[model samples]
Target: MTSSPAAPGSRLASRLGFSDRVFIGRAARRVADQIEAGLDLVENGLAEDLRVADSVADAASRYLYEAGGKRIRPVLALLTAQLGEGNIPAVIDIAKALEMTHLGSLYHDDVMDGADRRRGVPAAHAVWGNSVAILTGDILFSRASQLMSRYGDRAIRLQADTFERLVMGQLHETVGAQPGDDPIEFYINVLADKTGSLIAAATQGGAIFSNAPAEYVEPLRLYGEKVGVAFQLLDDVIDLSAKPEETGKVPGTDLRAGVPTMPYLLLKTETDAASAALAVQIDEGVARIADGEDPAILDQPLAELRDHVVTQKTLELARTWTRDAIDALAPLPKGTVREALTRFAESLADRSS
Candidate 1:
């Protein structure tokens, strides 16, 4: 794994994070190289983890796993590990299992969202139908649990807790806000449970496995949750702005699928006449989009919404959450681990994709 910095754009370095700056000169080369190498092992180990006895089962389980992803969870786990022992074998194992959990979630998510594409390819459900796709997700989750079991109770308890949160997150989204529940608050809570919980586990698990100071664990967990919320909030913005080529998602994919996003959700809160008028347009537009109306028909509303105050508010909220994430790192000692994570959070906030 001693892939020293020979090329700036080497394959190993390219795999580290969404930002090109992640494994470059931002952190010490030795530490960056070590994490990059550990991630490579995680990637290979993931493929082996997905391997099954029946060829059909193998192909089904490996479909989404084979398709490329950002590997954000694994990268985060490895990055936090730099705080303590620096990507020990235990940390690598945690990274692998977390990634498996993430991949499995994507399979079911695509089925639910009716998403045709993921990671630049047809989603597993599109390729193999929903039943097989769901079963593949189950297989991946089962394997993830089996792998975590190897680490004994500490790991198993963490796995069980994370799994519960993830399910609750999805459940809340599906059932939506209850009476007396604030819509925005409910939405953010769903983001925390759905997206934030596993990310929190990744950072927390890194500290646990790498023998980092106990005090670092909670702060890192907080950082991970805020980062996850910020990531999804920005994704809400990108859903309206980014092209399919840029994000591997059609512009308005979430709206077209009847999924609620921040910009539209924020519009629902306005009481002023123009804002109220635009809110109706957005609701109607989303309904039309869900009914298979031509996307071009909604371009006017989309453009207006893109430049609207609510959209700007969504971006502002994302930045706020991102700042909170950085603030959570105050407990961490000032060093390479903190710097790398700080830059990592900054890059995610600013990413276009």
Candidate 2:
């Protein structure tokens, strides 16, 4: 509890490896240390879990898992477990499984997104092609399920339900919103399915596996889902970052690729002359980029869009989600878990990357 991330063999010997957008103060620091220790075990376990006998499948399956991610999902899992028995073997095991599932999902996401890179390296789909990449995802899912099976039917059901939501999210996104569907609402729901549901599973599963009060489970679930939404919404804003150095991707990349961001989606909902005018400009910018004009040609429009009121609207909406997420912790009672989670929600409200 007295050690920092740099200290050897005390607590938090390694870094948290994500944005410092969680926990606060000395009490929070103690909680963070405990979570960090659990994460160490999860990291080591994932290596063993991800190992495969097939030479080629080995490389493909380990691709993104080794590439390095924020591991926020597992972090959440371990953190909520603090509310009960702390990082028991079951909690660490489930966190590792959740992370493997998350890592696997990224392989599928890269293939589906046609992404060139992931975690600063060439995407598996780019390296080995789509079929191999998708297969890699399946391999990781199998590994995760094997890990979960040791925990009994509850864990199995959790993995199955989360995986189902992951599929439904992709299906809905691929088909596009139905006629008469509120596009904004549909998009948020899709985000929930794809992002929030898994995160919810992580948070709730933490409490459950740790033997925390049953009443705490749903609140943590709600908190996690909303926090997940807020996290992705912030990513939408980050996607528009003019500084490629920060986001490691092009500005307005989503719009150019015909993928809609909430800011751009909000453009349709706004009837104001400014929003209307900006939307028209963005439309033209997207067109030019699609027509083989330099991606840089869209930079100014993106910068303007980045500063537009709709951008503020996007940010405020993110705040609203976080506010609701924190409120979901009301049933958690006053304690380190509740306070740490509240800080976590607050931190996401301001994350730039």
TM-scores of all candidate predictions against the true structure:
0.93, 0.91
- Residue range 6-72, candidate 1, lDDT tens digits: 3344334555343446444645666676767877788778878788999878998877766666677
The superposed Cα distance between candidate 2 and the true structure at residue 332, in angstroms, equals 0.8
Off by over 4 Å in 1: 1-12, 15-27, 242-245
lDDT (0 to 1) per candidate: 0.82, 0.83
Span of ten consecutive residues with least summed lDDT in model 2: 1-10
Q: All candidates: CA RMSD in angstroms?
A: 3.3, 3.9
- Model 2 lDDT on a 0 to 1 scale: 0.83
Tens-place lDDT digits, model 2, residues 166-220: 9999889888899999999998998899999988999999999999999999999
